[model samples]
Target chain A: MVERRMPSIRTTRFSALAPLALVAALLLGAPMLRGIGAVQAADGGNTIESVAIDTPDQVRITFRGEFPAAQATAENFRFAEAAAPDAPMALKSVKAEGRVVTLTATQALHPTERYKLEVADPPISRDVTPSPWATLVTLFLSSALINNFVFTRYLGLCIFFGVSKKRDAAVGMGVTFTAVMIFTAMTSWAVDTFALQPLHLGFLQVLVFIGTVAAVVQFLDTMLRKTHPALHRSFGVYLMLITTNCIILAVPLLNAQGKVSMLEALVLALGSGLGFALALFLMSCAREKMELARVPKAFEGLPIAFALAGLFALAFMGFSGLDFFR
Target chain B: MSETTERPPGALQLLFNGIVSENPVFRLALSLCPAVAVTTTVANGFILGVAVLAVQVLSSLTVAIARGVIHPRVRIPVYTIIIAVWVSAIDMALAAFVPALYAQVGLYIKLIVAFAIIISRLEVFASRQPLVPSFWDAVGMGLGFMIALMVIGALREVLGAGSFFGIVLFKTKPLLFFALPAGGFFSIALLMAFFNALERKLTGGTAKPAAGGHHG
Candidate 1:
């Protein structure tokens, strides 16, 4: 039998080295190098300058500013074009970087187009204002339901399936995930906006987010174990699991990318959390019935689960037709 | 001499185990979340497979080597931290290097740390086995997972979008459902049924009962 064979040292070394060599090759591969170039080009360009174009055929303008305050309204920022100052081009997208705002116009600018953008007034100071309490509500609703992390963006799914074996467990995991997501998002947002973005520590986002998530999950586990023993017993095991959950770590990083306000981040977190809950809940319900369905011997468990999830994904796609919000 | 004589399985056996017998996604049922989420496109599926393969292989190797020194009580957390470090490294490298694929995969890359496949293999196989055997097992398992993802992704992409890896394979309008949550569920179900049938036929109608045989 092959079992009686003593594997040669050369074979052992070759087997181990094979994968490492493959990984090295992939890392240094040509596609990866080209991709890096593209990223650099994409991130390249002006940091803080505004451009306005006003032509007979079209009018457009673009500018950047710091993070918008809570009460900062679209109406406050004004734009004027050579064609019509009062009827300036409509705002297309508002992308912000710290205090610099990059506003794009819907219509293209004419050949000799020129336009102007002004802040009109400084946003309410963060210290003076209540940190846009309403923004938090909006952010929560948007992130938790509307722009859900799991169903919508499909982040942190590895954990979604792992902890969602039972309905109760799924709900418990969802709650824990939401709590951790909000906590991590907020903390990372602060660190990114304050420390990383300011001091060029952007490279630290991944390290910081992962560290924060691991730390937060640990803290929560310890606190729950000490304070609510029964609750901990139910959710404790799943708590440690959250440290590796991508949604908890990824949402904050994404939130920072979108340059969302604190309130907006909360809404994003809530929406994502609810989305995950929705997906897991539906999955658990389906799996419950799936337990009895005469699945093939090979497709008995996880394979069937994956197929079932495919169906669920199909159903969730129905929401794509919802045009209530762009 | 008894222990030395009891050498664990060979490399070929380990490799075959991952490909067919104990497939991470289909056979063992580990790491289904990314399997479902990233299978929207063949390219996505392929890239995800590579990412997961790298993480699983490295994490498994690391865990296997340190299994003896790490205390049992703190083992889980230690395993997680190690996995997280690799995941973070991968995440940053991808973001910095391949922004397009990075954007498409997005948070799914970071979530590799939480994938049960890596932890499952680490605990069940890698921890007990020697380094060479552990490495082969990881490869086999990783290949199994990649195959599963590709199958689902190809089906979804072809039927849902009339494309494979973004290339237009057909001009027909896609069955929009095939691309959505409902489609994901239905596809897995049908595929599972098919796989079961295949297994039954392949084994001459006498495959061994599934592990932890749940009737459901």
Candidate 2:
């Protein structure tokens, strides 16, 4: 029965996506348009929050203040090795993220050595423009592309492989999964913040999180059935499958573990959902095309698909070293 | 109506079935995520496999014992709760006793409740079988999963990182690609194909394994 209706339904869905694509383009561009005002309103003074070693060769200095966009010269900051105060550490590059600045040293610093950081007289650039939105955008992009749930984290392979046999089903599943992810992420974060943390019921995190995801999916299932019968029929099975999908549950657990703010959690959820969708779409397209070009018997079904996913993972690995805000 | 009249496969056969013929990772293709994700290192893979084994056996045992009492309508959720309780117990235990392993695999520990392998066994094998057979089945499945993970983990560590069980085999890694997530996918793909080919040859093309399905 579903096979008979698939062709017509797919065509209609494609047509429907055109307007959505346009709206998505405009919405995505909306943030860049607002960037003109993104130069933050800098307050009079700034103070250092904390200094921590981010990497073997890098130290991150977080500030409880904002500044305008300006040159963050190495000389503006001072790093002294406690053992050799006279011979200061050399800074190679300095990147700023409004409230956070990461300094890369020319040489790797010993993990055991104590280092002291001092904001020089000219401090981080007075021209440093503060932008909270940029931080959120960076977070979203990093989570979606750099640390993708499917490619990098390996969170949702079951659904990724199961529903990716066909392109239309993949797209439908991606969209449905994204919506459910965003909704569940928000609900789980809220519940953690409001109920679990306050009541000291953190031990029940797994139980509560899985329960919450199940309830939300069940609710979405019924609501979609009643409101949009056509949509439900297409997405009903995927919805049920998503209740136990690792990605759905992982997003909330990650958010809670990271202790990210509500806004950050939402962005993470959105990023992860879109990332998974992107992976699904790409894999489905390749699989649909590969239907004609199989050679080996043993590497026919999942083996081939997995090999393809490995290629995609390699491709996505390129995004790890990218620094957009820098 | 003696016990001898009711014949079933011996416990040894059940164990063998799980480890080879019906291996969870190779045959059923269930729970492939952790099979690939944590297997980058031998220790990570072994620890997660052990944790999963513990959870699988306990959940299967519980379902087998209480199968009659659990309502048909609410069985799925009941199975989930049972799995969750055991997973939570293991999660806390690892954290308290083995904090290092806990830190590396803490998130995945919680995710054991979502693994299709455990729940599927509970629903299919445990829910119907009596206590003793179910216990054997669980043990076989658990050991099969653990052994599979260890093999994969050892492969990745040796080929990717130039190490075996955290001991350096050489000064340099053989192929850095196998250490990355992409390499994980490739290794698993190759292993899956290899297993399939071996199975086909050994069975003289008479037997065919079931296709992979929805997993968490």
Candidate 3:
């Protein structure tokens, strides 16, 4: 009876996390999914009505209804060549008006080779509203890996380099950073949604966001010093440093700029914080090992560390330009 | 920034120090994040460089003029507010006048508020100094930043994209790796190492462990 009950509990836990696992699996499949044919529209009415090759460099796509211009940017369309399916066509410009989107390639499309056009986003943008879960998951994963703040975007290097020298410090700083990032992101989102946006004071975004982050960091510093003295001692100074941290500032600014929902904002913050933490941890481990190795005089400390980061950035590049959800 | 005498250094000396000895990117290692992010292209880097220069000068001027009134306890916040104001003005100007360049660097323009270089200069130099010296220091630091970024941007663009300031140089990219985000790291690392070697050669001093590590 105990064994049977244990299996039942395990299965229940698995079911609870099933969506998250599915999202990861889908994210991993993005590169492969890029080569696959167009995802059939949920509502057949919204499917591509016609695709005409107007010129060597231009492909005109028409939809059933007025294709929202917002949904017709270059990123929404993917083009593949028959000769080299893996190589995406380089688009010079994309113009959308009424029901038409005209894509102009940088070079003339080969007259002989067949080509495939996939409208990766617009159909969903128009017809099937992305569920909140999907939006949240996409933002989270994209921020964490595909568009990693530290590796790809290069935000927060001062703390990233300063604390990542030691494993223990890295872990401590990473935790403090994530907690602070989430709290700050939440506060900024609230201020943005309630105070700033309604007032038509968009110009105040930089001032307000920085002020909010600074206020939050100060509040956290005091609160931690009192409540968690041990933890404060470990990473207390880092709290003050968090004010000028590009990552800390970037998250709230990004959230405001994107006009993301609150939950989506939270997920973005969590993801970016985790991504930065991951970068720090990996660099610390590598740096710790490098301390023992022989090094040239010029590339002793930061130079070698940056070299290591360059390699890591190369590895992270695999995640770029991936389409997570069809 | 330690002064040997009670008197401040001359303007030329200050400018020389910023451009060579205490270059923000290669020497001080301040604001490395934004430096690398915007240096992907010469044009982008130049635009950001100009923006940073303007902010640094404006903020420094503001801080120096108002330093007498600003309390020591709240100087950091005051400096920040001043920086944010200048950055927002630049951001708005770029968006209004040069919308194309603004589109590329709009996010980074807003990000200048948090840059360690501008804030550090304000704290270390501007807040303590008189208006003229502060102005010169800001220019020196700003010029150093701009030059460093332009150098990195030119190298990256030439190597990565086979272009210099959007003018195609090579028929094909010399090394596509130089254009990617990874390439940004490598470019800075290589240039930093090279600068270190050059400095050591010129100064006849013992090799110094990376100064970039001290920031943030």
Candidate 4:
């Protein structure tokens, strides 16, 4: 009887095709370069006009084609008193046309005072609304606490789980992660808004964002390693992990999509990072206690940790009803 | 009776291990991030479940076949690269073919790369096992993950949205938090408590009593 040989053709074909597939990906990815170029061109020369309103009451303002019509209905659109910079007057009513918008105010206008009309991006369909400086302050506070990134949005779970095993490490990692998130968000916003948007490079958003995060994390790691040895030891592992943390990646993309101003972007990044840190701190404390507790064989490590996280998440839900910032 | 006379466990054993005995989410508690994040709606859960299943199976196969050739020092990076490539391919494919689901899942489609479950399996079972056993193990674990996600998603959707898979099952006010981040926590906690209870009941007092510390 002749010895039968099994067909090795499938395995051979798979091995042969793998390199070809990679080559094809590279070739197809070439369009990404042109796309990025388009994004850059579009965002580079985009000019924004900041109009200071001196009126204390609501003012009806209209715009023409120069503004993206979507800005007429932005949620962050507000009127502030020129005399009292802290008390922002809300827009009573707003109406918009192809290029013009009419704003009506409920309060009286103060003569020769400098008030600002601000608009946040998501609620707005257009990009032309003049966002107020106060909106930036609010965004910072809200993003950092009320609408925190990690505790609320649950981004960066992997790093939160791994490095947060100890309280001190968690605090250090949280602060470092927040700092990295802010830096990464700022760079990504600049790149996306200035370089990519004008060039129609939206398709490269994910690739670019991931690359930016990885580079930022690596740079931060190198800097920390050289500057503060003890601090570096505490955050070194978590710093490397931040490369893949989604909050760092997600915030910049969200900023671009939301079309927020530079100030607004910074505030949002700070808030998100702070929120992440807060969540990590709480989780670490809980997990530390869990370490000493007697756990069943089946529910020892990851399982119990997850269950605890779930409860913490539920506790954080109470903030949703506090519509102070919304 | 010699111990060597006992028969080794079969493929069915491997399959059962993944589905129930060693279920990824509830039992092993692996892949909790995606399990919790995507379980807001039934559709999201189903889509995520499929993504996890595909990544787990393909990555397991690759890791098992190349286990001996790859150096242990570089194993993590290699595994991550493999998973990232597959995840990106899935993300693009979804963007092209299933645009609606892609939009709903959004950036999370790319997050599949970071899910610990896929990497954990690669490190634990797939690396040491043969291709056939690894394949069955992946299927079992994948199914286990799918079931857990679907359960959580269904519960959340029904309670939070007052619907299941977008269909209004009853005319009632929804618990909005059930759809938000908080609901993600509450639902998972309750599910875990239920799992603990089930584990105790199934083992018929054979398993050791869970220590108080483990009770989340």
Q: Write the per-residue lDDT of candidate 2 for residues A1-326, one digit (tens) a residue.
A: 77757764875477447535743763476355322222232444676555555446877666776633474678777777765666877889988889888889988753334565666743432222224455566677788888999999998999998989999888888888878998999999999999999999989999999999999999999998898677787779789889987899999999999888999998888888888988999999999999999548888788888999999999999999854333
- CA lDDT, every model vs. true structure: 0.64, 0.82, 0.80, 0.67
Arranged by lDDT, best first: 2, 3, 4, 1
Better of 1 and 2 by lDDT: 2
Q: Model 2 lDDT vs. the true structure?
A: 0.82
Q: How many angstroms is residue A138 displaced in model 4 relative to the true structure, after the best TM-score fit?
A: 4.1
Candidate 2 lDDT over B70-164, as tens digits, reads 98789999998999999999999999999987888888889998999999998878887888888899999998998899888999999998999
Please list the residue runs of candidate 2 whose C-alpha ends up more than 4 Å from where it truly belongs after superposition: A1-130, B1-8
If ranked by TM-score, best first, what sequence of candidates would result? 2, 3, 1, 4
For model 3, the stretches where C-alpha displacement exceeds 4 angstroms are A1-127, A321-324, B1-5, B205-207, B214-216
**Best candidate, DockQ:** 2
- By DockQ thresholds, what CAPRI class is model 2? medium
Give the count of colliding residue pairs in each prediction: 55, 9, 0, 41
Q: Which stretches of candidate 1 lie over 4 Å from their true place?
A: A1-87, A90-141, A155-167, A282-315, A321-326, B1-5, B64-69, B92-99, B165-167, B204-216
Question: How far does residue A57 in candidate 3 sit from its true spot (Å)?
Answer: 24
Q: Which candidate is the best by lDDT?
A: 2
Per-residue accuracy of model 1 over B39-122 as CA lDDT, tens digit each:
778888888888888878888899878877888788766776777777777778777877888888866777777677787787
Q: Which one wins by lDDT: 1 or 4?
A: 4
| TM-scores for chain B, listed for all candidates | 0.90, 0.93, 0.94, 0.87
